[model samples]
Target chain A: MAGYPQNPSGYNYGAPPPSQQYYSAPYGVAPPPYGQHQQLPYTHVASPYGAPSPSPSYGAPSSSPFAALLPSTFPPGTDPNVIACFQMADLDGSGAIDDNELQRSLSAYNQSFSIRTVRLLMYLFTNTNTRKIGPKEFTQVFYSLQNWRGNFEKFDRDRSGRIDASELREALLSLGFSVSPFVLDLLVLKFDKTGGMNKAIEYDHFIECCLIVKGLTEKFKEKDTTYSGYATFSYEAFMLTVLPLLIA
Target chain B: MAGYPQNPSGYNYGAPPPSQQYYSAPYGVAPPPYGQHQQLPYTHVASPYGAPSPSPSYGAPSSSPFAALLPSTFPPGTDPNVIACFQMADLDGSGAIDDNELQRSLSAYNQSFSIRTVRLLMYLFTNTNTRKIGPKEFTQVFYSLQNWRGNFEKFDRDRSGRIDASELREALLSLGFSVSPFVLDLLVLKFDKTGGMNKAIEYDHFIECCLIVKGLTEKFKEKDTTYSGYATFSYEAFMLTVLPLLIA
Candidate 1:
């Protein structure tokens, strides 16, 4: 049942450098390989739960024939990187990982990170169709946010600049989260710290926000006393500062 | 790291009764071979956090040393089931299982069917100076609890009929739960459902509460539209329903 989950064995990336140093670097750059992420593009940016409709000025994508999103029994090529990502995404201990499931699986830990925005990024990056996503596909989408913005090659599901709400909703559902237009509204507001109706969510901004959220969450877990990664503040503190936000 | 964190390799356990079906009739428990809990007791009680604690009246053992608690480490060639229980207690993933740590961990997961009055059991079970309990010892304890109502092999380490505020506070810390005396009092009022004057806080009860908290938290997470695992309804329900009967 175990042996790198799925993939041909003996796929060695060669020996790593003896010294393993920490990467305390800032965002926008990739981490050193062997577990760190390099930035790339993705498509299908999730809107807020209550996002405003796009204006007519922003036209739809160009139509072209491409690899359509559908169930494919064909084996993903022998790439260890893609295999690693599959191992993480294929929850339930299953060998094959669907794209939609990736969001739910990643969201569990990602939400553990601080800041409310990772949830938004989680929705954007996950593949909703068939619930499985190969590692090669996931990396480019994750570091770059291919779904919301970026080039057509990454998300051109059928090579179109368009993805639909069902796809986005399934991505959220796989991770046990779904953004209604209401949640979408909140997402857009956070994306637009400037308060302008930015109208569309793009790639670079998505990656920036995702990294910030993750860093903050790691710091927050250290403060939680319950070992469940939550701040165990007293009722008084929680009520005065935190309760209002949840109720709202 | 994935193997027994407490017991390194070189441990032994007979293969499963290939004759036995894995899930057709229960996961099958055979004194938890391979971890520290093998010597402890087992119960079917479904509380989330830890093993169940025994009550005050449970009588002491005439056979084992040090009242009731088992030795942290058994002689080599110990049964696999015994090893399993001991390993479970190595909460921090350290290889050793100390008496203090065992009490906290068993109490943390108090599987309801585990031996009760854990603090007391811990006090009574340390038959050796190493002050630790291995799987054989833990599984034995767990089995005894499941078979009997409660056993005296357990008593608050201090030997008092009940756990006072100070004793309770100290016990909490030794287990990695850093709560204030006030918080402890609140737990007492909530969990010490039996309003006795010297409300002795048994280790089993501590575990019961943690499990309850975890269960409720999980439920709230599922119930919430946001998947944040938060909500006023969940909060009030937890404080009002679970808090009173389990804590101070």
Candidate 2:
């Protein structure tokens, strides 16, 4: 479905103002009202895949500290802050950042993505022939991370900086996932930070979990074109399809 | 579904007997009968995802030229033929093969996969953190490719060495992908060898098409856990989810 551009301009790399630390909101505290942020241009466009309808806003800023630093050399529509981030991550002055650099950079920013997640990001954003991502892809990766961050915070309703099982269910629901309780439990077991005791998911693990679920479900749906829960696969097709996401 | 281990031993790098050129079967000719080949062990185990009963055999061989050459240093269960192929592809003697090497090696074998297909293969089989795939991953890739080759030949019903739209429909169905006519048309358009005029897909393109469809379907199914055929995505989530498979 069509979601509003959560953060059209880009993600803010600078720390949020003290009163607006939505990510670290204390337990039992509600996040700031969504209306407080500046509204983006309201024009809407359908995704090439024909996604439909706007969902609720996840808190996203319309501007960033690097907004005014756009260099003419980059592609148009490139996010300046993304370029800034990419440059910072390209520690070897090689004009590109590999997976190790990406992981270190995100961790530096307190994102702490797993090596797997960083690798997936690199696979998606870079030429698969190489491990490095250039500025153009870094822009897309940056914006996508910001979008996911907004969604994660929206679901961390208790403001404890993590989402418990029920919050995860609601979060997934908003994203159009109607997973069974069994599947939800599986997800919690897969991503839960407390090893199934608390059933709570921190941000990085949540992204990895969601990406895998979404990826696998999509593959199954291709075969289950009639909407049957059941789909068939040859041993090889099954292995080829599942192993990449599961083991990679 | 669980499938007969079509090629449990491994793919044969040596040419098949001249009389059994199944891949180049002329139009209107049937492939060799299924009973003519050596049978693998009849054991069956459910996939972790609980796939169902075995489908028909896909004409995989139970032995290969390199089977007797198993290296002492490799992991157990490692296929000798796959390791041999990996070493041949590792032009730099780096103990691994990168995407370019993979594409070149497949081409040398007359597989002629597209760069994009090679990228996806690398993404699925290798550590995403590096562009290189080690012997262990190469073994999986080799087996998976042989499996896909069997499936592709199975659906090339006319023995024309390529699949047409209707054949593709049947092929997808055999894999439990009951795609609609519109999607079938789209797939043909996406992979057609004659620029959509013939609506035919070569063997290499067929694998790529199936991989994309399978990957995307799996992703969508995660959100459509209720099997509703519809899923919602935040704008960023949508982009992140689809771009990797679509544009990578």
For this target, which candidate reaches the highest TM-score against the unseen true structure?
2
Task: List TM-scores for all candidates, in order.
Answer: 0.21, 0.40
Q: Please give the DockQ score of every candidate, comma-separated.
A: 0.01, 0.04
Provide the lowest-lDDT 10-residue window in model 2 chain B: B40-49
Q: Retained native contacts per candidate, as fractions?
A: 0.00, 0.00
- CAPRI band of model 1? incorrect
Residue A34 displacement in candidate 2 (angstroms): 16
Task: Score candidate 1 by lDDT.
Answer: 0.34
Model 2's lDDT to the true fold? 0.52
Residue ranges of candidate 2 with Cα displaced over 4 Å: A1-248, B1-74, B126-130, B225-228
Worst 10 residues of 2 chain A by lDDT: A41-50
lDDT for each candidate structure: 0.34, 0.52
lDDT tens readout by residue for model 1, B1-248:
12123224312122121221121111122221223222111111222112233222222332356734643345344456656666666776666565566656645543332332343343233322234454444654554444222221132555543454445443333322223334445455444536535554554555433333333333333334342223333222322322221111
